[model samples]
Target chain A: MAKGSVVAIDIDVSRRLGDRVIAAHFTTGPGLTALFGPSGAGKTSILNMVAGLLRPDRGHIRIGERTLFDGATNLPPEARRVGYVFQDGRLFPHRRVRANLLYGHDLAPPANRWMSLDEAARFLGIDHLLGRWPQSLSGGEAQRVAIGRALLAGPEILLMDEPLSSLDAARRGDIMAVIERIRDELKLPILYVSHDRAEVDRLATQIAEIGE
Target chain B: MLSPEEWGIVALSLKVGGVAVLATLPVAFGLAWILARYRFPGRVVLDALVHLPLVLPPVVTGWLLLIAFGPLGPAGRWLESWFGMTLMFRWTGAALAAAIMALPLMVRAMRLSIEGIDRRLEGAARTLGAGRWHAFRTISLPLALPGVLAALVLGFARSIGEFGATITFVSNIPGETRTLPLAIYSALQVPGGEAMVTRLALLSVALSLGALVLSEWLVRRTHGERQRRGD
Candidate 1:
């Protein structure tokens, strides 16, 4: 791996879904890597392993010289400092936009607010939505909030799984701008996932097509 | 024709059942999450046993309660010695019985709601640096609010109508333990107490209907919010 490179070594994981293998072999790399494939093609599984949500049967994940997952040294998601944004933009429904941003801020150590709550909101164009409940947000708006929340945590690397796949065409266009802006503004590396060729071309710096 | 003595029973019943439901909500939520999200040995057995009270005759449940919470029982004895508190024949004892009876209902409702929540949301939380408990409090708990409210209402309704278990475990001590159902049963046995029975029965119907309407309104209101968000 090159200096400051994010590398995911050969990974093998399997789960018996009533005698059938639900997931199998998976491996990939960093720098806006795209896990492009059809539904149930094990794309999400690969992302989950990288995020430490699913422990791999055998593999290693290293991001920017930090060992996130290895045979004997497996770090929990929080400790790994790997930020993951899901396809559905899971904003805390009860919390105000500002509070949701602060939630991630609070979880990070008190070193320096690398991305302050105000900075995150402004960067994501969600400053006006700081006081509104998530229930009041639009589909595209919620995705932006989810991304802002992830960024505010000051993670070393960000993983987004089809962040725009759920939005309408218009909404998808609007969110694409926010996504591109964040990618350029933040020095941290990102691993974005999507099966849409247009979206993959638009955002990804490198593409790793799965099951192709 | 309910005398003031009977009126006292009405208030006592509401007091016990209301407090019991209130106490069960938080505990039930925790247990429900454990059942809904985690996989562990004996989980199936634990799930079945939680519903045992629902399947068992209320009388049998009452007897078990009596044995376990009677003055001579171990838990009851410890309560008396350690906290100078007594449960047998007290209104608190009736509340305890109602809570046990209502617990499974609350857990079931919460479990369903928790299951409905997207696990991917939780995954997002974990990557955002939330610990397990923090993720639950901030993400899971909020998303499952509608279900939690429904559970509270259902548990409260179940506690209010409980009769056999309440009567058997706590007995019908008029001033201390006799709740609405016990009072209605006692009134039925008296001569010329027809008017009182009619009044109490009406009250029960009114209370239950009010809860049902409240739950419906709550469900509609939350559903609207979710739809608007999706839009």
Candidate 2:
């Protein structure tokens, strides 16, 4: 594994579910790297490890120049500037759309406020939806909000864990366009997890196949 | 005739129960979060012990409190020496007994609510730079607020109706430790005071119904928020 600009992430994480083993070994760079695998192939686990939600049994994870996890140095999720988008959108239920977006912006350092709340809303096409509550959002709309929230964090990297899995095909198509727009706009790295090969082909510049 | 003493009993019961519940809420929330979200060794044992008051007779709970908080007990002596406070045969003693009885109910309701929240929401908070407590305060606590409110109201109602533990620990001393339930029990024990007990019973029913209505309103508001969220 080379420690250089070309590889934005280097991970070798293994987890066991009783006797079964779901393991991954990969190094990904600035563009989108999709982890394509079957169900239960540990796609989500890898994303969780990168986001510091699940500690890998024995491995290391580094994003850019910072070490997010190692056997000894497992940075808590808050300390690791890695953004995560769960499949269900996971919007803060009590928060209006603007407050949810601001929640992320507030956590960011002052220097990262280059993308103001207004800019973030405009970028995500969510300006009109800001005052609305989360329950009012369609599946596509909610995922778009989730993406904007993550981006507002000024994270060094973003991890999407099967974000379109719960949506209908039509909804997924709508979000795919939003995601592509995000990729074009942000220079940050993204580790996208999905079992769908078509999504991988459409979104990923690099592909890491997990499981058998 | 409904005497002023009856009103005193009602006021005392409300005061003691409300104070006890308010005092225990922060602790109950902490315990519920620990039980619902974490997996530490002996956690199951701790959880079971918290619920022991529910299963054990209230008189037994009172007996335990008496042993630990009686005038001659070590805790009682320490409280007197350190804080100049006493619990034996006092209204404070009744509050203590009620708090112990109400704790499990509060914890259980909060625990269920905490568990019901999508864990992914907390994970989302963390990635947004919230530490554990921040995540809980902003994400977990708000989402599970309906359950927390339910727990508090249930605990308050339970404390108001406390009898066995209050009688055993604090005794039914008028104007000192006699709660609504204790007053009602004493009235029933007398020859002609049964009519007085009937009025008190109606009061009890009214208080409990009020609490239930409040809980329902809170739940409806939270449910409406969830509906708006499209969940």
Candidate 3:
């Protein structure tokens, strides 16, 4: 574990999907901890548990000194203050990029907000696309906006679930560079999920192999 | 081309229909949201109750409404004592009956739209720090707007066409409760009243057709918008 680790989690959770039971248990003291595994390895489920979108049957999740979930307490997603970048850029279809990016920023308390909308937009190179709708943007641009939206919420930790899988090679490279900046520049803790070993090797500071 | 009396009837019909729709819109949306989002023990029963007005005889629905909302009944007595209001043989009673008749259609339209929304988007909103109500207000509700508008229009059309319920609940008193359908019915009863009945009936058909066309157009426009956006 790195000195003054940003996140620590040990959780056990399972859910039944038809005949299959998907389950995950992991403990990490992290920089950017990547859960590397195959498609059905329950990596996303672990992230969901960390973000409070899923409940763990046992164990606990802690960010710094704050307990997000344990045997007795489970914070809801909104209260957990986690920035989540989904596989698909789940931007609001009705909103333009500016509003999508600002949605979380405005909901965040002023004392907790770390970056201005313009700063985050410029950092993600999405400042030019603010007026455009999510549907009008290419997959890459939309993903970048998704990241900026998450970051502007001033989360203690970020969760990225195979955010590069849908992009072309060139776009993947661009987003990988952005992820590097997030890890190095902002130094935000991240729990990333990916099946691609090469991607994990390049981006993750600590890799936790999930499943077989 | 209507005489002043005929025009008055049309205006009255519009008033009752408009009020009925406006009054029912929030309640219908609430019910639709609940039905679309949750799975409770008696969800099916609640759903069936909402649809009861549609399947039951309109007169029966009206009779139930009369029992509940009459001046001497529980709700009616409370309302009379508290607000000094009565739905008894008044235009307001006609509006109430029309609204009840229209509720099922409104709820169905809104419920389908609410259910069709990608709940994942709401999850994303929550991860972005929006509370449940905030996510619903800003995300889910806007996405469901076209359906809500369609519901309102459909409910309005249904309200104007409501005759059996309105007459059963409030009776057909001219000016007070005689809407388009009731006016046509009244005209049909008099000697040499065919011309008046024909005019009112044509107006009724025209209004209902216009509403249905508008509702269809709204639904189609939403689909076209979604497709064009490649959603």
Candidate 4:
């Protein structure tokens, strides 16, 4: 493993969903690491563990020099500073787009807030949607807002859990462009989960196959 | 179209109902959240205890309250000695009875809404750097608002209609504990007070109907919001 790696995850965790036991174990380093696997292959579970949303029954997670989880320490999700864009954009229904974008931004400490709400909205091309409600936005538009919301939180690493899976082909291309810009311009490390071979090949600097 | 005395009864009813709902709101939400989110030992018993007042006879509930909160009882004695307060035969005691009776309905409504909320949204909030309490307050609480409002209205309606328990526990003091139902019952005891009884009963009916309608509207609104969100 490179000492300068953006994220280091060597985790073994199993979750019982009904009678099926979904378990995962993998490790990746630096830049954009793609977890490629079919559906129900526990790809999202890995992203969840990285984000501290799911605990590993064993092993450890390290992002940069900080130890997120291990036998001796387990940091909660809020303290982990991981930006997650879910398959379904989980925007708060009660808040307007602007409020949703700023929800995490406001909670992040002043020094950690690298992006302003305006900058994020403009970057995601959601500036006109500030006054709109989450329920009214299109699927693609909602995902952009979700991305912007996550970025404004100033996370140490981004976790995209099949974010493009729910969009149309055109919208997928558009979001893929956005992700490419994020990879190149912002240099933010992303742990992307996708089964799309083309998407993984196009966006990933390192690929880790799961359940192969 | 009521006299000053009748108006006083309406005011007292509103006060008691409002206070009962307000006081019970936090306790109901807490219990509802617990019931909705966690599976733990004695959960069934806790749930049953919450619903006990709903099933128990109003008079029995009143008797229990009197025993527990009366001047001679342990809680009653503690309140009297420590806080220089008394509940026996007072409006506060009437409000307490109303709160207890209204609790189960409030908790049931709140729990349903809380349970209906997607836990994933809370997880999203957590990944956004919100602590558990912060995420719950901003996400789960707002999502559950309509249900909570409906619960409050339902509880208020139940409190205003509280009759047997209020009468048995507080004995329907003229101005203090004589809410709408109690006043109507009191009017029935007097000869030629049938006219007053009829007027008060009609008012009670209207109040309850309005609350029911409002609660129904709130519940529908919640469903509509959820549907629009594609949930």
Q: Give stretches of model 3 more than 4 Å off.
A: A1-30, B71-74, B77-84, B226-231
Q: Across residues A1-212, which tens digit of lDDT does each residue of candidate 4 receive?
A: 11133456454556665665556666665578898766887888888887888777777777777888888999999999889999999998888888899999999998788888877877779988888888888999999999999999888788998899999999999999999877777778888998888999899998876763
Q: Write the per-residue lDDT of candidate 1 for residues A3-44, one digit (tens) a residue.
A: 243444344544443443434444445446666667766677
TM-score of each: 0.81, 0.91, 0.91, 0.92
Q: Which ten residues in a row have the lowest lDDT in candidate 4 chain A?
A: A1-10
Candidate 3 lDDT by residue in tens digits, A1-212: 11233566555566555665667666666568898777887889888888888776667777777888877888999998899999998999888899999999999998788889878988999888988878889999999999999998888889999999999999999999999888888878888998888898999998777663
lDDT of 3 by residue, B154-221 (tens): 99999999999999999999989999999999998999999999999889889999999999999988
> What are the Cα lDDT values of the candidates?
0.79, 0.85, 0.89, 0.88
In model 1, residue pairs whose N, Cα or C atoms come closer than 3 Å (at least 3 residues apart or on different chains), thus clashing, are: none
Best candidate (score: lDDT): 3
Which candidate model has the greater TM-score, 2 or 4?
4
lDDT of 4 by residue, B91-173 (tens): 89999999999999999999999988999999999999999999989999888998899999999999999988888899979
DockQ of each: 0.46, 0.57, 0.56, 0.54
